[model samples]
Target: MATQAPVKTISPEEYLAQEELATERHEYIKGEVRLMSGGTPKHNDLSGNLFVAFKLALKKQPYKVYHVDQRLWIPSQQIFTYPDVMVASKPLVMQEGRKDTILNACLVAEVLSPSTKNYDRSEKFQYYRSISGFQEYLLIEQEQIFVEHYVKVEAKKWSLTEYTEIEDVIKLESIDCEIALADVYEDIEQ
Candidate 1:
């Protein structure tokens, strides 16, 4: 029988350093690094639409919006992830000397794709909840006009609201930003 090599577990610092030099992005969870898969065209459109909506709504405000390129650090769970869309109202918290990784995000949004839908709804979201400042989570669907909004009601407690119609408006109580389903699914053919 042939013996296989053991998988290596790397520290967050090492993962970050290596990630900076790599061409693709990855998510670091509990010392394990996994490459992020690509999103579909409809996924991109939904994510882009939401990002634009938040950008315009939070204009001239203290909130800063970031897309998938930005890394989010969840200290409690030792996780490093890239949310589809993130909004930080308070002063951004960086990882050590780097400005690309933020520790605090008021709202995090994920556009659900078939490949990552399960992880996004379960494990990934479980990690995101560890962030002290995380207040809202939006799970947007690519195939239909559906959105599952989870708002942090109190410590460790979250409330979920679902919207299924294009005319529905998602009220993001955390940042006081409202997202219209029509706008989010605009130009999306899937």
Candidate 2:
């Protein structure tokens, strides 16, 4: 029998160091790296709409809103992925020796894509929940005016509310921000 060599997995520190110099974005999970897929127009629009709404709603407040390109690290899960929209109510927590990675986020939003919807809702969400500071999660469907809002009710417990009508409003309890369904799907044709 022939023996095969074991694959080399990079450490989180090594991944962060290389991530800074790499041109394209990649996510790290469990010592392995995965390339992020490109988003569609609807996806971009939804992300932008929510970002603008959150930015406007939380203006002049202590909360900070971050859109794409801001990497979030879940220390407990050792997963590094970029959220479509993120909100921090307190000072931004930076990963030691790195500015691109954050450790604390009260709110995280992801616009669902057909290619990643399953991963986002299951594994990805489980990873996000590992963060002690995560309070609310927004899962938006790009194909329809539907949203699944998950709020942390207690440790390891959550409440889910679904919104389907354009008139529906989602209350982001973590940052005291409210977003109307119409505002969320604005400028995007069905």
Candidate 3:
């Protein structure tokens, strides 16, 4: 016979306290605190490349480009998560007491790793759509030259665009930025 303790959910307040002092990043969903695992080098490279591309493109603009560390708060879902890359032109709206958590995003991107690819394409995409200013979602594969781009066309409707060729240029509607897949996968292995 075996006995297991019931799982417990912590308040977002408690999670925030621990997150501030903890070395690792965590996602707060509803009332649960889930630790975020580290990504592979390939994943890191793609994220870095994407961030660099956005930074260079919006250098003089008023937009803010964020990499993995900046957290996003989805009020509708009561969740806190970090996107691989995010570009925002809307006015900055910080989570009530946090400078690192933002409430606005025009584009949110995720570097898809094997373990998270399915989730990122489904549940995570749904969560991202809840952002007030969110319009475009980018899902980039770390193991291949594939990107699934989604642009919101209407309420509850989004148009899908897929790119598989290295020469493909991803036009981000919300941010009015274009990035090449070759640049994103630069120096990274398949």
Candidate 4:
């Protein structure tokens, strides 16, 4: 008979503190820790293009654009996530002697990969919707032409719109900015 290895269970706070100290990135899901995978060329290109567009449009504005390195802490769920692109309208929450929590984000974009597609569309989307300041969420596909835009409608409702073609313009009503599909997929060998 073969012996099975023992399992380890950790609390969200422990997971977060450990992840913070490590050099690599990880996602916390209901106290479970999952290692994040690397993005492909297409994913990197799309994220870069979107970041550039947001930077240009929000230049000198009150909002600040944060790229992949920045981590967002979701207090309700006790999770830390690194969005591909995030825009914060106000200063984030900071402890007296600790780092700040990205609590003022208005818009967050996640470029979908094969491994994270379902999780991003479901679990992560649900978590993001719980945030009070989150107004817009964009999920861009890596292999195909798919972009799902979800805008907060009322207090607890969200309106979703999908764009599939290169000619379509993704309208971000929260930020008052519009981006063409071609610009998002710019130099990638589609």
Candidate 5:
């Protein structure tokens, strides 16, 4: 019998570089790399609507908004994730001469998919809270009127609020802006 070749696990740096070189997006967690799935029609519509709303609200302000193409790096976890929408107040960090590591993001939003809902609501929410400069995290659901907002109160505490109606507005205290539930779900089929 022929001996099998040993498999190799790529380091975070290698994974990051490879992702940068590739045409498609890939997320790195610890030493594992996984290709990200494309968004559904509903997901895409929701994200586009939210992006427009956020852009309109934050225009002429100091904040900059980024959509899905951007990636955020969590050094603590050695992870790189692409938030559906992100608002950064300060300049982002660069790696491999690319500005992919977003720092000073005051608000991060994720349009929840069935596959990623639990992770986004629980694990990813916890990880985002670990960032010292992160002020708010938003999770929007597609199938229902579910919206979760996590606002950091201080170094050790955070407030949890959930909105499940189209009439509700998500108030982002850090940015002095409010997002209507209807605006977020606009154009989304469900």
Candidate 6:
């Protein structure tokens, strides 16, 4: 029988130093870092649509909507991630000495990819819950018109609402925004 070498974990500092120069982005958890996977066209479209929807709805509010380019830092979990769509309160708490990463995200949305749907639904969701004001989560399927919405109803508790039809609408209580399934699936094939 052959034995394989154990996986090595790098410190968060080392990961950030390398990320500064790398072309592709990476996610950091505790002391481990992993390169993030690329998204499909459908994934990109959904992310952009959701961002625009939230941005327009909260234009005059004290909230900011971030697209894929923004990084989120969960201090309690020691995790750094790039949410597909993040709606954070104004005066975003930035990681000390860093401007691109924010410390608070009231709502995080991810467009489900076949390779990452499971992680996004489980571990990733768990990480998001650790943030102080993190309250809503949206997992959107790229292969179908299905969405799983999780709302934080109480401390350590959450309620789920799923949407399947294109006419369905999600009223995000966390951020006080409404998004239609049709708008999210607009121009998206399959």
Q: After superposition, how far is residue 71 of candidate 6 from its true place, in Å?
A: 0.8
Better of 1 and 2 by TM-score: 1
Ranking by TM-score: 6, 1, 3, 2, 5, 4
Model 4 lDDT per residue over 1-190, tens place: 9988855668866875797698888877666677889888788889999999899888887788988887787778777788999998856654234574576678999999988889889989889887888899999987777899999999988899999998899999888888888888887676
Q: What is the Cα-based TM-score of model 1?
A: 0.95
RMSD per candidate (Å) reads 1.6, 2.0, 1.5, 2.5, 3.2, 1.0
How well does model 3 score by local distance difference test?
0.89
**Which has the higher TM-score value, candidate number 4 or candidate number 5?**
5
Give every collision pair in model 1.
none
lDDT of 2 at 76: 84
- Summarize candidate 3's per-residue lDDT along 130-172 as a digit string, tens digits: 8878899999987789999999999999999999999999998
Error of 5 at 43 (Å): 0.5
Backbone clash pairs for candidate 2 read none
The better-scoring model by lDDT among 1 and 5 is 1
TM-score winner among the candidates? 6
- Give a tens-digit lDDT track for model 1, residues 66-157: 98899988888999999999998668888888878898898999999888999999998998888888899999988888899999999988
Candidate 3: lDDT of 76? Answer: 92
Overall lDDT per candidate, in order of appearance: 0.90, 0.91, 0.89, 0.84, 0.83, 0.91
lDDT of 2 by residue, 37-83 (tens): 99999899999999999999999999889998899999888889999
Stretches of candidate 1 above 4 Å error?
Answer: 1-5
Question: Which sequence of candidate numbers ranks them by lDDT, best first?
Answer: 6, 2, 1, 3, 4, 5
